[model samples]
Target: MQTIQALNQGAEAVDGEGEARVGDGTKVWLHWRATAVRNSEGKIDYFIAMFEDTAARHDVEVAAEANLELMQRLSALKTEFLQSVSHEFKTALIGIQGFSEFMRDADQLDLNDARAFASDIHRDAERLDRMVTEMIALDHIESTRANLRLSAVDINAVIEHEVAVTKISAASAIVTNLELKLPKVSGDEDKLSEVVRTLLADAVKYSPDGGRITVSTSVADGTVTVSVKDQGVAARADFDNRLFGRDELYASNPIRKVVGTGLGLGIVRQVIEMHGGRLWVDRVDGEGSEFHFTLQAVDASLVTPGGGRVA
Candidate 1:
């Protein structure tokens, strides 16, 4: 049975009934309640507190812990599968690259035909490599094995590098605004790279030929900011919560159009959190989506001449 009151004064909330919820953060104390009592004079006398029914809270906590354990196990299994897939694909890619190179050297097809075929092969190989790299990166971030060696990297430089690696040309006019003085943010380079890489990828994916993706960075007050804004249609008004969190083979909703494993954004969240940062997906006019993340910029003393902070 739960105790209704305590006979002693100076009773702590710990010696009470009912939970005391701490503020905006997360922390709960159970079996705690606080009350006050007065004497015959109606003046303040003492307080009464009781502690009871901790078993229910304990059961809930245990269930939550069990669920966490299950999720970790599932994540580990998925990591292994991704690694295996990457390895197999790598071997296949080598064979295909060899054949393509040989065919290019032989000059069997007309100039136009050869060029087109070679370009296709190159694109496919690059895509495969990107996929493998992303998978391994997600594995590292999820496992907390990512190094936090924060650097003051140039936002523009990073964008240029990733674009070069992906061979994505600035075909659209909107792809032009990647230059901005972002606060010399200090965070793990690998993790930050994953964030921007995913955002740019999604932007490129949803963007049509005429579409423009505005990648902007700005520093304000003391907070550093980075944003990937796409001209693609924002998410539907009816979209519930599947913006970047679906692991199933198909889209979870009827209005879903894109093909994805929903793993990218979730991994983004993990990476940001690991760096003590925050990430969010905002639906612009409920017609398109933009992804953003923020990290605390390191001090000037931590920065080098190139803007990347020293490890």
Candidate 2:
């Protein structure tokens, strides 16, 4: 009423309290202005009013705000990942540098002592090399657009070969409980081998000097499951709580001081998922933890239309 009276008094006024009809006949918050025109006798003429709808613009602003918040979160995650990687790299370099210095200044040492220094230097160099290689592999696994090759693989053979070839055992015993008649599964052998190697390496590193590590396999319900159990500091609950959540970025925890790049399990998880499998942790009362993963077994139903079994 005040706006109408202002127009009647030969003045312009704005009415921004009401809503306007949209293209879909829905009402939205609106802004309007009225300008009164005068005739030659100075009497008020008809009024011209304009309205602007603000809902669409408001929606756009909201979406942009949400996207900005998401970007900020991603930036923070990138910073954290970089910091973790840098720390791991520096730790590896320290080992190499310290051992190299020891090997360089062993002039007065006995032959066995000099050989030991050389061995330590070589071990440190190997450690650094492993970290770099694993880092590259993690980057590839995370970003690669290529699809995994589906081939019939002997899981038992892959496990045996990986266990036999790995020399990282600091444990007193490694017990293998492999199923002799394990069925073939569709997977990439190399990636699966890496998974086995990563699990075994972790077990060896975490287990006490005389603790036992056990590798086992079983098949049921068209799935083959493999587990690596380590008798070390038990963190199964901690691991399970974060396995599918935010714990992926945590490089180390208070449970152990073992040296690692912290990307091995991440890569293992990626590879297992790529093969249409799942990985998990199982807590043992006094036997530490067991890491398990499952792969679909090759069944006769996977036979193609051409009567060829899926390989």
Candidate 3:
């Protein structure tokens, strides 16, 4: 029998009978009773005996903790709403002030410095736009807004449309490698395009100077890999665990220093997941990062293929 000392969630509490050891992901409640005992030298010490088999109590606590988590998420959502609203108001005010000042002192202001200030205002406004859009997107996903509008749209054409809309003139060079395919995806065309477009836009924002990003789509292992690969730092070795997160932006963009509110991926993830697909970030070792979202290639065996339900 293992000597009595202490036990916690991370460590195993060996059963005195050698039957089992507490393992990871085990739902357990731990309680200890302290009793005074005399040592051989007549000194007093506390002997703690742990009690187990409190499943009902543990379930009650788990439910309470889950409710607390829900409250916390709701609180966080409220905070995000307040901050986003304030940011939008501030951005509008700054734009008005900046453009008004630029117009009033057009002759005296140095053009370069004025342009930099203008850029800051522009970036903030864009940031606010992305934030608002993501909030709406998350809501829509949660609601599972019904739109099964399916069409025979060319998947390749949609990629091109997104690329033309989000052209980046940064030091990084955007190279697209989207190959053609057959039996177009039997799903909503507009929503799928948004997923690819947003992912590419993000990759461009985090790439290095003269960095290259390639967009590719192909069928492999009965799954389609719609990927946006950037020749910049992919996932930070330190923070790869939280890839589908925005608050981890500083970790992702360490050197080139791209500015982001860290909410885009959360939205992107929601959209991708709503479509009954897998979304993930893969690091390219010596290269950059590639975001590969997977979807069922086609429904050839099902013939009709109209029962597309979101899981």
Candidate 4:
């Protein structure tokens, strides 16, 4: 009302500009404009008032704000990731240096004692090598996504092989309940195998004291889904309802004690996506977490009557 009165008194007023929801529950941002008209005698005559719908502009502003927030989060996570990587590298180097020094001062030690030192050195070197190799693999996955090798590969066979490998040194008891007749999926076999390996390894890593790890496969609505469940500690609060960022896996809480670059699941996710599939944490904050992913199942028509590939 004051704005209207101001316009009537020969003064123009353009106020009350913001957003609101109308009776139909649609949101709109309004930009109010008011102008006072004058007669020949310079006396105020009438007023013109206008409202412009600025909803689209307001939406753009909202989107920009969200983008800024996300960029900020990514920046912070990157710093954390670099720090974690540094710590891992330093630990490996320290082990190598310490064991070498011990060998230099143990000239009189027995042959068995000398072999133990060599083993320690080899173990540390392997740890460092694995770290560098994984970092390279992540870069390759990100840049060469379009070059993925496509073929009809058996997902069950991939699961079986990965489970056997993980059980070799896994403290946890690994088990599989695979559907043998499940359809093959079209994807890069090596990359798909890495996905399975990473998930199983992650399960064992989180359950250091040994627990049950189950790998399963199922089909529904033309999608082949695989799940890896572990009986480990529940995920931290940050990962309960959201996916972990690259550095989030190294969060200074419970996971800080767990050894990883925190990029394992992240890499797994991108690979699944490259195969036109999606991966997610199906269950968390429970007895343990279950990681599930889907891939396009090979069409039934593509297989011969004898359950063999048409080719």
Candidate 5:
């Protein structure tokens, strides 16, 4: 139709580009050009049209655009990761340095005051260690170099131990609602323990004013789910997907109030995945957050009246 119109209007040439499906049902980019061939009387005549397949060039252009976008995303992630690491390190270092300096130069430090300062320093040091450990653990898992001592792990025992340890340091009250006679899971005890610990610590850290943290475990369809619910500042709806992502250390909302390297949750996700499980978080009644993860439940009958799995 355009070719006929161009010819009737005496236009010298008409050109356009569009996408078309080929005989193989594959879409391809095409460019067409139509030229008017006039008669000796300088009147209307037939038009000649030529079509060129531009799929190859189009593919190259699209690939280049995708690569550019990927590079930009990677650059942004690097910047954010560095900023998060620097902030966490600086905060811990400041606490350690201030407490050490105060203890060193104090004219008459009482026994209780000295002990408190030392405890503060130790806590800061431990935080620094934990941050470093999480980074390394994530790296190892990503590299597939992590050696997991997989076994029939008692999930309740891991949760109970982590909750108890967290209660000692957490200002919030930690409660557990573990199911009895729960089936064991095939996972590394140490790694599972770290997962629980990370979740509990996050709960305590976010619940700055000391709220109740409930840790619960349940089983369904050969999967055991553990949830850590915290009555703290709820995460934004948009930030839910990025919560376990290593690239996003903190959200640009109320969740950023708590200081963290953001490596803990990422590591938890990796560990859970390595154990053939999944992890996720949800808003608790629009006022708090509940982090949950699932592990493959082992059959109860596979055990020989003991905690170990039978071959």
Candidate 6:
């Protein structure tokens, strides 16, 4: 019909491209051209239409476009990561330098003043060390080079210890709902403690208004699940998937404030995954966020009488 219309409009040929489904319901890209087969009288006698399947070429073009987009996204993420790292390092260095200079320039520093200056320097140094450590840890885990000293870990004990440490300076109220006598899991105690600490710290950081932060643990189906729930700025669902990504420090939401180098959660994820566990986050009753991770619980039947694994 289009060819006939074009011919009646005094066109000798017409061509276009579109999509169509073949007999097997397979979608295909098609390019069609119609030419007027005219007699000597210069009037169109019949139309010769040709169709070419361009599915392969179309697929290649689509793939190339997608690859280009992915490259651009990665380049942008790299730029963001470098900028964040530099800013964090500079802030820490400035504090350390200022405190050191104050101590060095004081004509007659009292014992108390010297001690306070030393403390500030130490704190800033620790912050710098932590950032570097997280970067190294993340790289090791991602490269499958992290050496986990796996053993039967008492998760409850680990959680209690971390909670006590967090309460030392946490502004938010810390709460625990740990299940007693939960089965021990096979993991690195220190790394698991780090995970708990990271989550608790995040909970405290996000809940700037001072709300309840709950740390809970439970066991089911040979798996031990640990979760940290916070009544803070609730992250939108669209940002959930990117929460654990290395490039994402905080959501783009204006209400969600960015802090640190944003490597904590990424490190937490790598550590958990390296220990053969899975990590994820969820919305807390439509008000806040909850971070969860699962570890493989040791089988009770496989334990010896002396609290050791059976060979």
RMSD of each: 9.7, 13.0, 12.4, 9.6, 11.2, 11.8
Ranking by TM-score: 4, 2, 5, 6, 3, 1
Q: Choose 1 or 6, whichever is better by TM-score.
A: 6
Candidate 1 regions with alpha-carbon error over 4 angstroms = 1-135, 163-170, 176-181, 237-258, 285-287, 300-311
Error of 6 at 245 (Å): 5.3
Q: List the residue pairs that clash in candidate 2.
A: 151-311, 152-311
Poorest stretch of ten by lDDT in candidate 4: 302-311
Q: Comparing 4 and 5 by TM-score, which wins?
A: 4
lDDT of 3 by residue, 115-163 (tens): 7877866776676676677667666654543344665445556666676
In model 6, what is the error at residue 13, expressed in angstroms? 60
Which candidate wins on TM-score?
4
Error of 6 at 173 (Å): 1.4
**Candidate 6, run of 10 with poorest lDDT:** 302-311
TM-score of 6: 0.55
lDDT of 6 by residue, 137-168 (tens): 65555444235798998887788778888988
Off by over 4 Å in 4: 1-83, 94-126, 208-210, 240-257, 283-286, 301-311
- Give each model's whole-structure lDDT: 0.58, 0.68, 0.60, 0.73, 0.74, 0.75
Q: How many angstroms is residue 83 displaced in model 3 relative to the true structure, after the best TM-score fit?
A: 7.9
lDDT by residue (200-294, candidate 4, tens digit) is: 88888776465788888888888989998887666665573333442344345353354456766766876787677888775565478788899
lDDT of 2 by residue, 277-300 (tens): 888987776677788999999854
Relative to the unseen true structure, what is the C-alpha lDDT of residue 228 in candidate 4, on a scale of 0 to 100? 88
- Give TM-scores for every candidate, taking all chains together and pairing residue i with residue i: 0.50, 0.56, 0.55, 0.59, 0.56, 0.55
The top-ranked prediction according to lDDT is: 6
TM-score for candidate 4, please give it: 0.59
Query: What is the TM-score (0 to 1) of candidate 3?
Result: 0.55
Global Cα lDDT for candidate 3? 0.60
lDDT of 1 at 131: 60
lDDT (tens digit, per residue) of candidate 5 on 1-311: 86678667777888988899989999889998988888898876667889999888887787667555544544454455567778878989999999999988999999999999998898889878877875666556555523579888888877777776777777888877776768888899987898898888888777646578888888888888999888876765675666354223234435334345676676677678667688888875546889899999877832222222111
The candidate, 2 or 4, that scores higher on TM-score is: 4
